[model samples]
Target: MNKLLVAEQLVVGWDAPVTRPVSFHLERGEILALTGPNGAGKSTLLAALAGQGRIFSGTLFRAAGARLALQTQGLPPVAGLPLSGAELLALTGASAQGLPPWLAACLPLRLDRLSGGQRQYLSLWSVLASPAELVFLDEPGNNLDRAGRAHLQGALRARANAGAAILLVSHDPELLPHCDRHLMLEPIS
Candidate 1:
């Protein structure tokens, strides 16, 4: 089946439900955006779908044997970490060919030496370029500048076109155009 995931009345949170029950499905070769206000639990819902957060109620299912990759808001502290940008990408099995010229040049440098946006983009590329059939991203556009954002949009489109199911959580208005559909979450009252 082309469908990669199915969620029905999924109520997810740490302790109590932070979002109203939401139902959505994701299919290969599509880009879905999760959008809402600050407290709407967009991140939490993504975590739940990835099997890393609590599901207080409802059902969530993934296609059998479907591989997935998830990119969260947190970036591992680069301080004194020996990893380089290229090394990070290599670890994730992602190629650097599509990286913007600026980022590509920084690939040989230690991640700690790169600027915030550079590190962010490198980390994003690790997930985006992976071979996972399903990709979950949370606030991916964070720390990205205008050019970075444009590159991200293009990369997302390329990934979707290549048959990866992408579900990203973002508040950036510019990212809406790259999405095939959106699931808007309302904060629980």
Candidate 2:
């Protein structure tokens, strides 16, 4: 397979090792689900992969020239800003062709005027639709309504089909069915 990311006995953390040494590999056109209870280092691992967190041990390898996009938990502090959804997409270079009708209609509206879910979904699309070869999403389902979740699943599938590797960190079981494989992280004692 075309490996985009490979982690061998990887241990990631902020101050110290927060994750047990775990190993995994990801390839283009594949969706990998990272799951575990709270404090299991799911988000930490994603951060480490995105070059934010520290890798205490082992190793992580990425395709030499691959670009990446990451969407972390919580909303961006763009509220009250003058940015519109369309502008956000433009900044990220993400297209609006596949946006849901409701969100599409709100494209011209300032981001602060939209509901939380709308903002969340729009932020997510910024990452999902970007040209990045690898995508990392942390708690992607947060604040999303039922329809939003459904759309997320479809978007993930489409991105994978289009040859982008995704590392999804979600607690929602609904997303697992869309993933090609799953890795369960364990908390350290």
Candidate 3:
């Protein structure tokens, strides 16, 4: 498998170091699970990898120009953005062919009208279907039902099979089985 990213004794934070020095790597066609309680710095590490936060210390490397996409937690509904679910998918070049009937129906509805699960599923689809080679997902299982999680599992597998490197944070036992590796984080301080 091709190596997509590497972190050597990496520490990340927004204003101050929130993660202890940690090391890890992500490879193509693989899923790396990031798990822990809140305040564990999982999201902060992701932010560093996505180039959104400070790499407070240590070294980080990526294969050439690895394209990265992030699906964050608690994305508020777009109350008046005038974007529909289908349009959102289109923006990411994602196809909703395998979506459940109810979710598929949401494709034409405005983003604000979709229920939480529908929006979460759609948000995940947008990233999984993106051209990005590396994807970072924080609490992807939020708002998803059993069926939605099943679909998410399938999608994660499909994306890995297609050679994308995934780093995801989720407490869902169902979703953990699909990952190739797991990294459990402990609370900072």
For each candidate, give its TM-score against the true structure: 0.96, 0.98, 0.93
Per-residue lDDT of model 3, residues 154-182, tens digit only: 88888889889999998889889889999
Predicted candidate 1 versus true structure: per-residue lDDT over 60-165, tens digit per residue: 8999998999999978777789899999999999988889998999999999989988999999999999879999999899999999999999999999899999
**After TM-score superposition, what is the CA distance of residue 14 in candidate 1 from its true location, in Å?**
1.1
Clashing pairs in 3: none
Whole-structure CA lDDT of model 1: 0.92
Q: 1 or 2: which has the higher TM-score?
A: 2
- Superposition error at 30 for model 2 (Å): 0.7
Which is the better candidate, 1 or 3, if ranked by lDDT? 1
Task: Give each model's whole-structure lDDT.
Answer: 0.92, 0.92, 0.87
Ordered from best to worst TM-score, the candidate numbers read: 2, 1, 3
Instruction: Find the candidate with the highest lDDT and give its number.
Output: 2
The predicted structure with the larger TM-score, 2 or 3, is 2
Under the 3 Å rule for N, CA and C atoms, how many clashes does model 1 have?
Answer: 0
lDDT of 2 by residue, 1-189 (tens): 499999999999999889999999999999999999899999999999999999999988999999999999988799679999999999999989889998999999999999999999999998889989999999898889999999989989988999999999988988888899999998886
lDDT of 2 at 24: 98
Sort the candidates on lDDT, descending order: 2, 1, 3
Q: What is the C-alpha RMSD of each candidate to the true structure, in Å?
A: 1.0, 0.9, 1.5
| Poorest 10 consecutive residues by lDDT, candidate 2 | 71-80
